[model samples]
Target: MHPSLTIRRENGDMVKDMPRVKLALVIDDSRVVRKVARRILEDLDFEVAEAGDGAEGLAWCRTEMPDAVLLDWNMPVMDGLEFLQRLRQEPGGDAPRVVFCSVENDLDRVRSALDAGADEYIMKPFDGDIVASKLTLAGVL
Candidate 1:
């Protein structure tokens, strides 16, 4: 279940309120994959955005950063690793939790992504449960 926060009103009255829906950026070249990820993220109460490639995703982040990024490893313009590296260099980029969602299962690649500031990793063909678990592990859920 999603967690709520207790906030104080202007009059000093305390109330329990649902947290703001987190924004999640889904970056992938495949329309089908993007659609599937959008559905899953929405089900988890995240406001979803889509990008066709890493370059597009980075452009979006530059404008308004999302709370979490569901990133794909391979694409036409820029790959996920390059995007991740460039993102971490941007102002406020470190604030978002990055989860690598990809089909690349190479040990070195995983290590490289984690080394490059990815908070978590999820293999491709992910289900809701897997996505949820990965997000939770990344401290975004």
Candidate 2:
């Protein structure tokens, strides 16, 4: 589910007057990569979800409805490009801005990702500033 920022009362009801947190998903095979991305997004004030692969990420997208996604290019089960293709076809999928984050710096690959519906692209070895910048450009931050 999309992560919540609501305050709960003593009886477990939501406390009024607080704004909901925006959700972001980090999809990559590497645990280290996911962890790094999660930390960056969280620092940007986003509630982050992580997936080990494209397939799992897509499954989460079909349900949770996050505000943004940081997707990797190479992964098991489903690659990032294939996942992007499938995600665009799913209901409400187009609503979340997708940022393709990978080591693949080839222009053609980047173009393909944009053509397939990615809102932005980030080269790997990205820092928190880069993540925040891309998310901002994509209107996710």
Candidate 3:
């Protein structure tokens, strides 16, 4: 049985009870980045969604808001900062914890993202441990 599932007996048969699955969105222009983040989030028991840019991400959120977001700082169509701003304006948008994942490590840039309503920041080339730690701190784990 998966860690997220509970095994039980029902009428002499085994049943797997699944707990409420958390949803996570990975918004980045890079397909590789999205795939990597999705793997980590899935391993953490979250159902993951992907969007190529901030515009697409926001559109997805409007339809089905996620519990957490892994956003890229830079992308065409709309940047992470703009998406964060717009997302906050949407109903139930404030509920998702947003984490900016990017290659930018400048202090000022980090501050700007935090000010724009990002819950945390993760430098790119991130591994599972780094992502897990950041998500845990952001109260998503």
Candidate 4:
């Protein structure tokens, strides 16, 4: 396991058991976008992780098993559509619900993402409130 990664089990017997933080993995090529998304999720009390591309995101998901994923449509080394398709094929209840975040607002793109198994979609330049509302709609908040 990577030294930077930590996974804590929720012990039922513990008196002060902290509610498992709703882990959210933000996958985007742009650092700024990832930072913004992380800030929004953090504001909602979620633990956030970031990946620079879809490949790294997939690797993280395999180990971290976050509760939700915020995926960017355009990225190097596996785009969001490909990631979503591959993720749906993985076996386990740990599969995180995914929301595609992108500047692509065309109907075809939206339809494609939905067809590829994304739970929701959000356009770029989004506000924290918008992200929260989308998460709420997706039942992740």
Please give the CA lDDT of all the candidate structures: 0.88, 0.86, 0.87, 0.81
Residue range 1-141, candidate 3, lDDT tens digits: 124533222135543445666778899999989888888888898877789999999998987788899999889999999999999999998999999999999989999999999999998889999999999999989
Q: Which ten residues in a row have the lowest lDDT in candidate 3?
A: 1-10
Per-prediction tally of clashes: 0, 0, 0, 0
Which candidate do you rate higher for lDDT, 2 or 3? 3
- Cα RMSD, model 2: 4.7
CA shift of 106, model 2, Å: 0.8
Tens digit of lDDT per residue, candidate 1, span 58-124?
A: 9989877888999999999999999999999999989999999999999898999999999999888
The true-structure Cα RMSD of candidate 1 reads 7.9
List TM-score per model, in order: 0.85, 0.87, 0.86, 0.85
Q: Mind giving the per-residue lDDT tens digits that candidate 2 earns over 1-141?
A: 333444343256864443677878889999999888878887898867788889999998876787899999999999999988999898888899999999999999899999999999999989999998999999977
Q: Compose the digit string of candidate 4's lDDT tens values, residues 21-126.
A: 6788899999999988878888898777888988898888777677789999999999988888877776652358788999999989999898778888998879
lDDT of candidate 1 vs native? 0.88
The TM-score, computed over Cα atoms with residue i paired to residue i, of candidate 3 is: 0.86
